[model samples]
Target: MDQAAAGMQGAHRAPVCYRHPDRETGVRCTRCERPICPECMVSASVGFQCPACVRGGSDTGPAPAASRPRTIAGGTVTADPRLLTKVLIGVNLAVFLAQLAVGSSLTDRFELIGQAQFSLFSPVQGVAEGQYYRLLTAMFLHSPTNYTHILFNMLSLWWIGGPLEAALGRARYLALYFVSGLAGSALTYMVADPRLPSLGASGAIFGLFGATGVLMRRLNYDLRPLVALLVINLIITFTPGFNISWEAHIGGLVAGVAVGYAMVHAPRERRTVIQYGACAVVLAVVVVLTLVRTAQLT
Candidate 1:
């Protein structure tokens, strides 16, 4: 008799969702305790809630601005506060301002001049004699004659940098920047006209391009647009009007793609270790090339 009574009670107690009267549901809103269907439910910090209760709840807050993404120039940037990108831009801006403050002296010192100007620095030494810093600092210096130069580089940096920095973290991104820039300088050292002096962040920015391309390709994105952009930039670099360093662009792009590939494809367990190791190997190669170029010069 007791079991029969219990069964009868259970059978009569079945509840149907308020939103959909025909469908049975046991889930209740955490806040209102009202039965809700899956379509009517909203996930909250505490538990599932009815849409009405969620709308009325005082505890919920808006999505964080820090993680929000925005589009600027040709790249996507998040509010996630990438310190490396800010620092790079700030340093570049400071150097640009300082260039305006002084004049040709800064350029003469930091610019990656061709072998002719390099030979004048020291005839008896390898590595351009006392001017090795140019390999790194030249990325910061630009054509002080053209404001457009710094503007475009900075824009490109802001566009491509935030995502890479976020994905690679601060240290690796910094390493990527310098390695690509140095490789560009190395190539410039080898291929640039001995009479020409080149300076700009094109190589570093192009490094971002290559890295972004690698990341995108890893995620199975089409590489056609990237290739097109590369071709267009190459054309722009050698277009006969603007004094551009195709060597830096090419070198940086290749290095970026290489390093970026290594970074994205590393074993998940030792991702950072392998990525850093790859950078080390690439930088070692750049150093070796520099030494060889210096040997040829001397």
Candidate 2:
């Protein structure tokens, strides 16, 4: 009897996730009571529930529309989490290819500049000349002569963007990306020499880095890896020979962290309002900075 009891006790082990059999998880679906890994879990009104329960309806019947599943940022959960990231990458690549085929034509017109003419005959152009579209267009461009520039930026985007898109969902992720990029542009316009041409996706990538850090913190994940990577990037940004735009990087990171916090930490009862309201506040700041800089340059 004693031996049998000991064997039974030894056999009783913590449950592994039903979907991902290799992953051990203490968390169980509130509806179905099956173990679930983080990837298989869905945010629920009460406790985390397995995706099956979330999709198949509760024991009482289909989950009401009011109780529909949502992402951490209150965005609707998507079937293809990385779709937006892929599209953004595609757009960047297409723009880059156009830059290559068209020589300096595309870049000269679109690259961010405060106020400058590339040559004596070139019509005076830039943000100060009312070409504010440069702020948005510049982010889709890179040094046409440097293949490595776009290569590195695209790789970083894939590495950081896909997971972020999954966590925040398409709408929230898109807003974060564009706002972060714009924040970088606004700061570059404000601080960097307006006459110098500036272009790259590093600012947006750095923004993703900041948001990823915030998201990891929110989920209680180990942050050492992200911190180390960010440290390296910062070093590259500030290193004397790199010629990187520290202003853009800093601006994007700060904006990303701020927006990411609002997305993850907002009250459940008012998540959408708080999340979008935070984005609006950031945009307002960006607008103020742009106007101040334009006034200085013009």
lDDT of each: 0.73, 0.85
Ten residues in a row with the worst lDDT in model 2? Answer: 55-64
Summarize candidate 2's per-residue lDDT along 1-298 as a digit string, tens digits.
Answer: 9999998987886578786687655678888898865445567777677656766754344455765556656666556778999999999999999999998878989999999676766665999889999999999999988898899999999999988887788899999999999999999999999888899998888889999999888766668999999999899889998778899999999999999999888887888899999999999999999999888777
* Tens digits of lDDT, candidate 1, 1-298: 9999999998987576675687455667777888764334444444456645644644344433442221111112323537789899999999999998998777777788645443454432223564677788889998888999999899889878976776565667788898899889889987777467888999988988999888666544457987787788788998987878899998999899888887766654566677888788878988887887777776
Would you list the clashing residue pairs of candidate 2? none
List candidate 2 stretches off by more than 4 Å: 1-41, 56-67
**Cand. 1 Cα-lDDT:** 0.73
Superposed on all Cα atoms, the candidates' RMSDs to the truth, in angstroms, are: 15.0, 5.0
The prediction achieving the highest TM-score against the true structure is 2
